[model samples]
Target: MHQQDNGKAETFDVAVIGAGVVGCAIARTYALAGARVVMLEKAADILDGASKGNSAILHTGFDAPPGSVEAACVTAGYREYLEIREKLGLPVMRTGALVIAWTEEQEAILPDLIAQAHANGVTDVEMLSREDTLRREPGLAPSLRASFRVPGEFIIDPWSAPLAYLGQAMAHGAELRRSCKVLGGDFGGTHWDLKLSDGSVRAGLVINAAGLYGDDVDLALIGRRDFTVRPRKGQFVVFDKSAAALAGHILLPVPTKITKGIVVCPTAYGNLLVGPTAEDQTEKDVADLVPDTLAALRARGEEILPGLKDHDVTAIYAGLRPATEEKDYRIRHHADQNYVTVGGIRSTGLTSALGTASYVFGLTEQTGFHYDPPESVHWPTVRNISEAQQRDWERPGNGGVVCQCELVTRREIESALEGPLAARSLAGLKRRTRVTMGRCQGFHCTARLAEMTEGHFAVPMAEATGHD
Candidate 1:
């Protein structure tokens, strides 16, 4: 968090651009290796980009093409996620995936998918009969021909992962700068001089995990384009928690080469999620919820879960993935420039974040950076406090309740505001404390949260409400 003053430049051993899940994980990895690391984020908070919105399904790499970086990283990352779940209090659900075959053509693809799963080191995948599939998922279409079950796939709280990693990194002396966009940077023979929005940063080495705008940063820094990041917009609809039972697993349609297809899955927070209509967008196309698309998704959901027709829609939003021309991830080390570009992460970025960070570290090590092991560090546990724990904090003035729908208390929201990775806006607070993100979607709690934030942080109402 140190900024240069009096024309004296502050330097670091490693500077990671983009505070997404991957970037935060890279920062934490570098910090654990005892490097003086600094994470620069363009947004006001972490997970504000593609990392903020996703299907939240931690892939098993079973369907991934073998021998690719994604395949390898996803396999390793799922294991890392299991370990991470033990340390952090984030909601990590081990809900396995069910790839349903509604048509004979889809049924025919199941064996090949099983083969791919085996090739990707996922041996627990099984093809189930239509009767067994119906037995497992009663709400599924009776037209089910067959299904492939992958037991390792899971769902997670996407926001909590990066926040926990960043919190731990910050606690271990890795600096984080919010709203600090890297406009450009120059690499000398021995170091890099980055021109941030506010000021300049000098670093011995740099890692670019700048998700969607990754290509822009790569071209600006390395002076070449190995790939271009085309934003693939995925629109999703979340049903009320009462309809969570519609899909007991990550119910997916058989994959097409173009997309994973629409999926009906349950969130770790007890809600059914559907759609994610994969419509690739041009550079100028913004990520917005298409009502027609949402309607189509709802219709598809009804086909997958007949009960969905009765359930209420809770939320609708869209996220853009940094899709590239290359089938695999575009991770390369510029040894001479003392830089590594981590780009084209796409859908599996969150699932493979830890493995990707480890790979980036290995690349940095190959470039001559070394790590000295630390004994221990404080890893912050950031998640929803239980009702019992909430009661404990009620005696203090911070215990007043706020979001009745989500049961968020004033104490929890304030903690998010005061934490190391403090919320800078309503959206930030929503990700941090789950306030105003429930069924009401801030209809009841936004004004209260905004007022408290404005008064406490001394910010204007617009800024507090995340209007700008």
Candidate 2:
């Protein structure tokens, strides 16, 4: 599996495992800070992990208690998201959010929730009177009595956020080795001895952000094993874009100590996202089993958004949260091992990724390790919104529509095939161009798109389905 690149050995100041939101953000942070970073992902593409498939809510972290690490990190990452999104020209729908209560008992929690929001430094949060709530969102359930309206809360296209981060990292001198699984590693005195699927990669620092399989990655050689993670599966049903306006603001059920309840939120892609059944499962391919939860999710979603019954479901998907037994983030540095373990990132991982990276970098600093910036770090420049992103395909050969289900054109597919972040599977194209993620679920478009990728990338038809 080993392949030589430009007849030279691959080396870096730090090797980041897993290209999920947290891992990519961490690698981007280091790359921007002038570190020679190399990212190793087990998958064919980056951000295809839980990062691409998430709730898509930009939380104010108001529901989190004050002084908790989760609170601090989410709050910080929320602010950082605005800056990064704007800088990258990514679309962030700053439409705000609300937590609605249906009963009197649920109403009682509103005041305390406001207090908690304030405690978390979210000062813009306010308890909405019945009239005020109606004024803001008249379409809300008429039975709702109390709610917390928090501005600055928004919805984002979850796919582009992490991809942009990793894209920026790659532009800024970070090298990414896709589908290169790290078999094991040894804690070198300075550089860690890495055993990758391709071959070996040496790094003075190793950052582990392997999500669900994090423990397995470090089990071969490690130090602190204070916590264990149980995979909690969350199933979601995506409604067609036509029904996206079903809710004006995010409608969230108050969370219990065990789990955050189901939420109905509108995504930046102009689609409604509902469900995400909080069930605990150990299955690795959880997304494939989401059909089993569809009926339950439909019932639960109707209870939240009644008007959504008529909207056709575009797709149903599930992503497993690496929920750990630990109450807070399981981030720790082994100075001697020259490794940092970033595991147990749950559903809120996306909202806290940037902050998590910054904190991890601090841990690296406190360890007394230092690196000079690489001599040459070139960042690839791309438009904030590509031509294909305009909903029109006018780029010569790229303009022929391929994925009719999502209005994705051949130009867009080809761009993904040849661009910096290429697509090797059906799911990869879905995340990048949102093709086949629409109402038909690629029943018609899958074949054409598959043919295009097969011809363009020389990949076998079977492997193009995103199956290993």
Candidate 3:
């Protein structure tokens, strides 16, 4: 990472605003393309915005609008993830998704949904009879009328993927600046001087991947706005690990025009996930979890899988999606200013981030600012934290287990604190190592964590607990 001096400004080929999943991927793409890339995040750590909370499902683009930018990016990204995940040590739980219909009206739409899936190149999608559906998933409610199987949808480690992307970018000579907010900037025709919270940096181009505050960044830096960010909050409920056995596949609801509706699925972390009620609000930063909405989600989960009523709720979280007035992604390039606005990326960003980065790179290339591709690209592998793979605790010389709930070892915590992409906050640590995020929810492990992370964080452990 380049340290900005008060007397001198650091320069780069590209400055990517926002270190969310998209921003991380963008940095990796540009860095691999041989551009001196620097990714900036406003938060204390990466993935702290809308990227923090998600279903963690890698979509097949089966239900995405055919021929749309989202669909194209999702297809390309899905392919790229599969191609590179093993090298990067990312985990994927191959739990195919089932779109279930509880009513005749929903069942009637199954064929059309399947048609759309086929149109989107998911040729293996097939409709299932109610009998077949119940036979495949005996735990599902008997009220389920009919369903279709999307054999491609799978659960993934949402945090690790982005971490690996940024890590690889850094390994390839890219820089990451956390807690560095881009206040505004000036386009001097030849380059951009982005004013940061601490100091300014000059870059040949700027890409806005600020996520929830993408619109605000555009207005601040470019002095114009093409779209408005209507924050859509989605609340989720995670059931205990035991509940994961109740459903082997991702049980999805038939889509509505506005949302994909509530989905009852299994997480890569061996927990059953039921979520995300789409509620539109004006707040950009805060994603307040409403008790009533969560209760409704639990009820809906139980309705989808009657066995969920017997399971205990492990956790609840809410994330804001940067929705816009239009359904398609709001990506535009201003060649004259050497700026690109990658905005309105709602859900499915995790699956489409790589493809989005490639798409953004192509747009930047159109501006005639090109760099030679690197002769050698570095692939950095992140430590495995998901249950699908053997954890650090299972390995020898891992110190000792500190968080029994998640089996996080002392070595894992120590390593997470010492790296260039080190966890600077409790929430950041949780995302990196899964510490204090299990059943106990830090009740038993926080003290140990505090002892382990002392003097490493910007905020003291006592004050960070509430925020985490």
Candidate 4:
């Protein structure tokens, strides 16, 4: 990995802006293809943006617009994730999703959605009768309606997946710069000089995978943009672990053109999740939780699974998606300038990231830039934080537990704080080790964590609380 020095401009073959999941995957792809790659993130840590909060479902693209880039990428990325997840120690909860139609009108749309699923190459989707739906999920409210089962859809560890992707990229000689913002750039025909917040770097090609700020990055570097980023905020509510048993499958509502609607699914971390009330907002960064919205979400969750009323609420959070006026993804390649813009990737980004990287790599190749992929690739396995597998606390020599609620160990926390992609803040550490994210929400572990993470975070623990 190349370190930035103030004395001179560092050089690389590729500079991928934004360290979101898509950017991480793009960096990995270029690095594996034998390009010297550098990934930049404006946040204190990777995934501190839109990538941080999500439903964590690995979609089958069953309901995605057929023949669209989103569908193709989701299909390819889904296949690739299943093919490589075991090697990376990524957890997959094979809880197939059920798209239930509560209303008669929604039931009328099931056949068309099933046809769309088949058109998208997911032929295993089968329509289920009301009896079959109730049998599959006994805890679901006895709503007199039918549903379709998308067997390929499953839940995955969202944070660990990208961390593993970037980790493998670093292992294969990719450099990551967190807290580094790309202020502007100059493309000089043969190469590009990117001006960052800290210093400057030169690269032969630049790929804009900046999720929410994608348009801004394109405008800054190329002085033009085809699409404007319209931020759409989605808030969610997480139930306690006990509620996870209520939903055997990912309970999904029939998707609308605007959003996928609310999803009541089980997280890989052994908690039931219901969320994502879609609200269009002008604010790009702050996705504040609304009391009334969350209350409505809780009520909707109870309506889906009547058993949820008995469970306590664990947490509530919100995420912003880089939505645009158009439904399709905004991807364009400028061969003359040696640039590619990947924008307008919304909710399905987690599942489509890898395939998007592959597509973007092909676009980069169109500019006459190519490299021989490494003969042998390094596959780095991330630490298991999901309930689908044995956690560090369950193993011997774990150095004792730190967060009792999540069973996070001292050793695990230390490891997360000591790596190349180390946790630089409380949020980063939580994403890495699941600390302070359980039922107690760090009530019992904050003091201990503060002692352990002192002087490590950019903002000290005493100064910052929930902001990180």
True-structure RMSD for candidate 1: 2.7
2 or 3, which is superior by lDDT? 3
Error of 4 at 361 (Å): 0.6
Relative to the unseen true structure, what is the C-alpha lDDT of residue 285 in candidate 3, on a scale of 0 to 100? 78
Model 3 over residues 37-85: C-alpha lDDT tens digits?
9999988889999999889999999989998999989999999999999
**Which digits, one per residue and each the tens of the lDDT, describe model 4 over residues 1-468?**
244545588888999998989999999889989998999889889998889988999999998899999998999999999999999999999999999999999999999999999999999998999999999999988984999999989999999999999999999988889889999999888888999999889898999999899999999999988899999999999999999989889999988989999999999888999988889988888898899999999999999999999999998889999998898888889888988999999999999999999999887787688887789999889999999999898899999999998899999999999978999999999999999888888889999999999989989899895753
lDDT of model 3 at residue 397?
100
Q: How does each model score on TM-score?
A: 0.94, 0.91, 0.98, 0.98
TM-score of 1: 0.94
* Candidate number with the higher TM-score (1 or 4): 4
Best-to-worst order by lDDT is 4, 3, 1, 2
The best candidate by lDDT is 4
Which runs in model 3 stand beyond 4 Å of their true positions?
A: 1-7
Per-residue C-alpha lDDT of model 2 across residues 1-468, encoded as one tens digit per residue: 123435654667889999998998999888887788899999877776667668888788887757877887898888888776656756767678888888898898778888888888889987788788878877666777878888878877777778788888888778888889998777657777788888888788899998887877778557436567677877888888887777878878777776778888887667888867877767654555555578789777777777777777877777778887865778878877888998888878888889889888888988776666557655443332222145545446566777666667776667777766777666666677778676777778766776677854435555554531
lDDT at residue 8 of model 4 (Cα atoms) = 82
Backbone collision tally, model 2: 2
